[model samples]
Target: MRWSKALIPTHKEDPSDAETTSHKLMLRSGYIRKLTSGVYNYLPLGRRALLKVEAIVREEMDAVGCQEILMPVLSPSELWKETGRWDVYGKELWRVRDRNSREFALGPTHEEVVTDIVRNEVRSYRELPFTLYQIQTKFRDELRPRFGIVRSREFLMKDAYSFHRDEESLDETYKSICDAYTRIFERCSLTFRPVEAATGAIGGSHSHEFMVLSDTGESEIIVCECGYAATDERAEGAVDPHPCDEAPGEMERVDTPGMKTIEQVSEFLGIEPHKLVKTIIYEADGRTVAALVRGDREINEAKLSMALKADLVVPAPPDVIEKLTGAPVGFAGPVGLDGIDVIADHTVEPLVNVVVGGNAQDVHLKNVKPGRDFKVTAFHDIVLVRKGDRCARCGAELNSFRGIEVSQAFKLGTKYSSGMNATFLDEDGVAKPFIMGCYGLGVSRTVAAIIEQHNDKDGIVWPLSVAPFAVEILVVSMKSEECTTLADTLYTDLKTAGVEVLYDDRDDSAGVKFKDADLVGMPLRVTIGARGLKSGVVEARVRKTGEVSEIPVDDAVQGILHILETLR
Candidate 1:
């Protein structure tokens, strides 16, 4: 490839709207251009990078005995409706209408479509225990897309779904795909951790997220020294009870005036933040439930939803809270509540006397006991785990860090197979739903994550395996026949030697070519110049390590190949 014929529009300055490091670097390097909010156009260089990542994913998925197939991006609404996800998917699903007003969806995932395919084709146990995969584009209507391609609306993904006749087969294939995913990310040269994660909208019993540690990541992860790591929504912590030793006093109503929040009440009563009880009102499956926890603890909604076995749980509106508790938003309490269930955090089990809402405007109750003054229907661990919290595994303190989710593997069990009626006949002549598993790798997001972990001040330092070009030959003066002739010879020889090389024969200045070369960040940079040619040598620079060396002009092709072998 020659630079003069390539569309490498390297920019001198970062775009004004770019926020994350990957976003800015990609723009400056001319890899991608923004088409709209949460949408982008991958230029030639970006497309090459994406293809490289796709190749790695394909190789791994193929090595694991998975067959590749392409599914339609536009799926009929009937398929989603059959599984009851048509309404459950909500706004993230891009729903549209055809000429006759029939509904269709730009698929954010292929579970429904893939299951539909299997149900129609495979009707017996003889066709069981195989994985089907595709590397394709996906769409999700993100509410607030940011961080470049990290949360984009449309992006490339590699998704694989496996069907099995028995639990044993499912387990074996799950482990195999998990191992393959590890190898895939490792070959991409990423430092990542696979943590236990909640299934979220994916509707699975078990899942693990492959996360790349980054400060700019959207997800917060809790990691413990005992090797227990999980996303904050799913991470568990010890519930150390704080017993009340002081004698209980009679409950009394105190005039809080305009004070409503925990901070205001704590300051007015001269008590620590943890001494007060926090009351949260939520609508779980259309039933108003009051959740009580320590003043300093925040509710983990995911855990709360699972505890109640509800399809959806959201914070009650101000009107709903006032109507149910007879108090304003922040003044709701659990004492003497009517027509609603009350749930308390496990941390409240040991408390003897605590402060709660008075259930009146601008009033609060003091010296209130849990069992005596108020009772909870259930106690569960719905507390959000934070930094320094005791780990549920080994009692060590947890550490919090941000990470980008690059991929996920799920033990889907029979969630989809049962819902979609994807069943097969057993050898004993009994029909059963297929045991299933799902694995996904975000191809475009992986590229952004690679830049997030591998770039510096200049630009992206692409690892050799995924670099658009392994070697880029930059001629100091294209006008000089000597420099151009030597650069042409080296480029031809490198290509003939089975190396991915880019020749910069454009009529551009040395500084311009050098800046673009570093910005694009090929693995090895071979500089051909009049001065170096006179010395019977050329310069080679490693993009990742910034190590420069002089190579004999006659052996330039071999020298570059040797360097490429050492990287990635």
Candidate 2:
């Protein structure tokens, strides 16, 4: 590719709306252009980089004996309804209607469609334990898409689904897929951690997320020195009982006008946040329940759903709260409350004389003690794990960090197959649902994450394995015939040697060419200038290390190839 003909439009200023480093660099480097709020058009350079990532994913998946197959972008609503995900996915599933009034969904994931296909085709146990994968586009109606392609509404993904006859078969395939994921990310030069994660709407027994460590990431993860790592939603919080010995005072209600938040109530009552218990009202599976946690802690809704064994768990509406507690929102408490299940966090079990809502308008209860003032139906680990929290494994202090989720693998079990009635005949002539597993790698997001981890002050420092071009040849003085002739010759020689080289044959200034080269982040650069030509050598600069060396003019091609080998 020649710079004069290539559409490598770079800018001097970053986009004002860009909030992350990857977003800013991708725009300024002319890799992509925004078409809409959550949509982008990948230019030539960006397309090449994405293709490289896709190739790696294909090789890894194929190496694991997973066959490649393509599914439709639009999946029928019947398939989603068979699995009861039509309502479970909520507004995130993109719904559309055909001219004949038939409904279809733009697939966010293909669990339902794949299950439908397998159920119709595979009828015997002999055809079980196979995996099918596809590299295609996925759509989701993101409420707030941010951080460029990291959270885009539409993007490219590589998703694979496996079918099995029993738990043992599913387990074997799950481990192999996880191993392939590790190799895929390693080859892309990403520094990541595979942490246990919640299954979410996927309805799986367990899952693991590959998170690239970055300060600008949206998800928080907890890691312990004992090799126990998980997303905050899945990490277990160790219950440390701070047993208070103070004698319980009689509960009394006081008029705290307009102080509802913990900060406001604590400041008004002259108490610490830990001395107060917060009552959160949630509607779980059409039943109202109250959850109690320390004011300083947050309720993990995922944990709450698991504890309740409910398909859906969301906060109660303001009207429901008002009708149940005889007060406005934020004033509902467990004290004097009846006919509703009251679940308490383990940390709230050893409290004495803790303040709580008064179950009335602008009122709060003081000197209230658990087991005396209210009844807790059960206790569970239902709080978000944070820094300084003890790990459940080795009791070490857990550390928290932010990261970008690049890939995830789920042991789906029979969630989809059982729901859709996808079964196969066994040796005994009995039919049973196939055990299933799901694995996904975000191809586009991996590109963005690579930039997040491997970027410098100038621009993206692409790794050699996934770089758009392996080498960039810069003609420092295009006006000088000697420099031009040597650069053209080197460019042809490098091409003949099977190197992906970008020749800057444009008549631009040396400064402009050098700046663009650095911005595009080619792995290696060869500088052919009149000054260097006079010294009987050409300059070779490594993009990652910023180390420059001189190669003798007689051996430019061989020297460049050797440096490329060192880069790998």
Candidate 3:
């Protein structure tokens, strides 16, 4: 595309309201314009970039045997209600009413709609494994829409859903899609990690999220140096807290006056935080249950929520907490509890004789033993892990970092199929619900994540993989005969050679032209200047690296190709 014919707006100052670099660059460069909070209107440049990304996604998804299909952006509320998602999905879902007052929703996702199609078409096991995908707009009423496209309420998404008759088929297809995602992110030039994911709200047994590591990321992923990593939703694996196998020490009580925090108590006793057992009280199933975890840990609320199978399980208030454990607000322990069930996090299990609450005011117990000193009705890996902890996989130390999730795939395992009675006839003529898998990539967020992972101080140094244009040919002085003649010739040469070029034919200054070229973030910039006319040498520059070379006019095409190959 020619720059004179394109809408590549360049700004000297960053927009005051722009919170993210991607948002600022995109707005200033005229890639996109905001319609409202959490809503955007893609301009010419952004539309081209989105089309390029969509093309790559289509190719990769099709390579993995996924068939492209278009589902309605507006879905019937009855379909969602059948899956129980309409009630459970909360207010994030946007609902509307038609002329008849029947409810409809702008799809947040297409699981129910896709499953409805599968339930009608796929009858026998022979036609079991099928994948259908689409690139479409999705709507959600985000509670706090921030970070631009990273958390937009209305955005474009590429969602693929796979249906299978059994677990083995589902597992095989799941692996195939994961591999496709690997290729997809690589093509987008995004540095990402596929970590184990939690199935919150979207109930599923197995899930994985592709997270791009960045300081601006909203979610945190705790990873062990042993290559063991999991997002909070699915990290219920067994983790031994690497306890010291010393003999059970004597039990004693120590007075802890006015110290409620773990740090305060640890400093008072002059012991490692790992040596203390932290007992937490919560209201579960209309009764108070005390959960004991290590001091160096935080409770995995998701795991606890799943274990209790309660309607809601959050941290209880001290007044409500004191009533259950028979102690003052700051003091509560597992001493001789019969009705109150105790849950132990994975880390606290290996402690031979640990210090815990004494079930009395202003006192705590030391050398307490599990099974011998206290009873635990349930055991789980609900402890929040931190650095220096051993890996659950290869015994390496753990580390933590924040990341933004750009894509996800999950084995839904009949969660909705069973609820909606989406069943097929079995060999014995009995109805069996189909197992399902869901895959999604944030089309808009991927664009922002690319900027997050790729940009530099100058502006967005768009990676060639997703750049709006491959080359930008700037005419330093569009009105000058020498510059215009050479610029016109170079533009024709590049375009005729099947290279995508954006020619800056505008009557602008050299500084403004160069600045706009950088701001537009095209990978290559070929400048036709006064020096080029004097020496018969045109300048070709690579945007990512501040490297420019003077090439003979006849060899301009070859120089541009070489630079493109080098950037690749």
Number of the top candidate by lDDT? Answer: 2
lDDT on C-alpha atoms for all candidate structures = 0.90, 0.93, 0.83
Residue by residue across 4-121, what tens digits does model 2's lDDT show? 9999889989889998999999999999989998898999899999999999999999999999999999998988888888988999999999999899999999999889889999
lDDT of 1 by residue, 45-91 (tens): 89999999999999999999999999989999999998878988889
lDDT for each residue of candidate 3 in 172-200, tens digit (9 for 90 to 100): 99999999999989999988899998777
Per-model root-mean-square deviation over C-alphas: 1.7, 1.1, 3.8
Off by over 4 Å in 1: 257-260
Stretch of 10 with least lDDT, candidate 2: 236-245
Model 3, residue pairs in steric clash: 198-233
How many clashes does each candidate structure show, in the order listed?
0, 0, 1
Error of 2 at 384 (Å): 1.0
Candidate 3: Cα lDDT at 548: 84
Q: Which has the higher lDDT value, candidate number 2 or candidate number 3?
A: 2
